[model samples]
Target: MKHSILLVEDEQKIAEGIMDYMNGGEAEYETCFTWADDGDKALELVYENEYDLVLLDIMLPGADGFEICKAIRAKSYVPVIFLTARGREEDRLYGYDIGCDDYVVKPFSMAELSAKIMSFLRRSKGLWEKKSSIEAYDIVIYPDKLQVFVAGNEVRLAPKEYAMLKYFMEHRGMLITRDDLLVRLWGYDYEGSDRVVDNHIKKLRQALGEPGKKIKTVFAKGYRMD
Candidate 1:
């Protein structure tokens, strides 16, 4: 399904421009731009609807973008990309602090914004459309299907565990560090520690069973699938 998007901007010209850009044939977005003259109206709409993304402007009549962002972050981790004329370093840092996924400065290219939006969506969903299958020794990983077979027998794995194993199978013989696994599988912005990777690895190993060297621990580095 096409993800729904909410755009909250007070300026009519700027809001129309962005809406047009988003609705253009080149842009593959099923977006609903909510042109709110004030933040209060935008916040109300946010509370009323479940949107996949929010494009917020910094300066608004009622609550302001920062306040609205904080309010949204309190309830949801919905992808937020700020669209504003405020290009100050402090404003950027504050936006990031409040969990803004991206900040686009004014006079930015619509094409670039579209690309950024696509990138964020892909990362958020881990939307790997390519169906990939890898066979490493006695283990087989089917990424598209989110299934695994160990020694030709179906073995159940958790979602994250399956992603980890699939990573290993594709990068067989490569010594992947804890950081590498965390970023690739969990996401680059994941706040969790490397211990999460270790825990998931343990689960993956247990699921794969004996001949677990298919997923080998490389001492201080991390893991390798041989």
Candidate 2:
């Protein structure tokens, strides 16, 4: 099937290479590209047209990618990816927090990126179609609403934190290793520090407040949610 992709980048050359691969016959998935040179124009495109996926650059002219990703998440569930030179752990975590579907550092392998793009696209095809809410003690998460409620009060959570809570709810009372989280949430292609999962877990606990105690850390192995 053919997919529509928005390619947002300031550099003329980098965008061209990606576009070439997507448009060229080499890619497994057939895709068409809409190019934007800056963040302002990118947002304009986002508002004006409907795209299946977005390839975003973190450092752009009008608004940075983090802002753009948050805006996109506020409106749509369409996949948004950060393709930038920033490889720092904080940046990657921040991207996940702001609801970016994936983060790819620059000087990257084109083949691997192409593969990841398709992977996200495929996985998100029927994403979040579930309407039922998952509840654990005082914390409740609605997959359809993308909202979290603690003690009957609505509490905002980062995207990654929300996902963690959902996963924990789904596997309550089961041992989930750090490696398990790294693979399940971050994907096998992820190259960031394993500490990212721990960082996210810490923040998720803080978000859940009193109910956070239910997430039991299993020594060095992993965590089990009650």
Candidate 3:
């Protein structure tokens, strides 16, 4: 599969070099790259296009890469790699804190960066293949089919309800906030209230019947699949 990558870097030479290396056939898979010299443009591409991975520079002309990464995290789980000159421990920690998949300091080798990108891509593909379907308790979810089975009986779910249930089943024990669900399922452009998440969760639970008992409401927080 040809993976699309967004390269956000201010330095034209550096960006071109990285792009050339990525597409130069050093790896087994083909990588097509789009270059963005400013953070605003980066965010615009991120919102409008679906990229397999993002190669982001920390300091940019408009908004910083950290802010861009946060915005991306709000809507999608696309992998983000910070390629920057800021090599401080705190900077690296902050990158991870803000949801960067990997951080590579400036003056880095293109070969190493290519290897890292390949590794992340392979792992992501493996995970998606492995999670094609999931079973928890008496509930089985076929994500590819958008079908749910409870106690050997198939349950019909609304689009959003199926998405919510699939998210819950995937995260299982993790606490999922309403904001997380809203941004993830409804998109960043959604102007609806957080109560929408509650309404959907209620309907999702009702749809699941007995298996829905595992979906627990956490007071003042969000829902968790026990």
lDDT for each candidate structure: 0.75, 0.81, 0.83
RMSD of 1: 9.0
Give one digit per residue, the lDDT tens place, for model 2 in 118-147: 766665544433336666698878887899
> Regarding lDDT, does 2 or 3 come out ahead?
3
- lDDT for 150 in candidate 2 is 98
User: Could you tell me the lDDT of residue 63 within candidate 3?
Assistant: 88
- Give the clashing pairs for model 3: none
Top-down lDDT ranking: 3, 2, 1
lDDT by residue (tens digit), candidate 1, 1-226: 6767788888888888877888777576566666677899988987887667788999999989999899888776677889999998668767766767677889789889887776556544322233365666787777657778888998998888887776565445557788666655665567877898888888777777885656878898888777
Tell me which of candidates 1 and 2 scores higher on TM-score.
2
lDDT of 3 by residue, 1-226 (tens): 7888889999999999988887787876899899999999998998898788899999999989999999888866677899999998668767766667678998999899988888768646444346566787888887768878998899999999988887776556667777667766776556779999999988988988878889999999999887
Candidate topping TM-score: 2
For candidate 3, the per-residue lDDT at 173 reads: 66
Where does candidate 2 have its weakest 10-residue lDDT segment? 122-131
Root-mean-square deviation of every model: 9.0, 8.6, 9.2
Note the clash tally of each candidate: 0, 0, 0
> Which model, 1 or 2, shows the larger lDDT?
2
Worst 10 residues of 1 by lDDT: 122-131
Model 1: lDDT to the true structure: 0.75
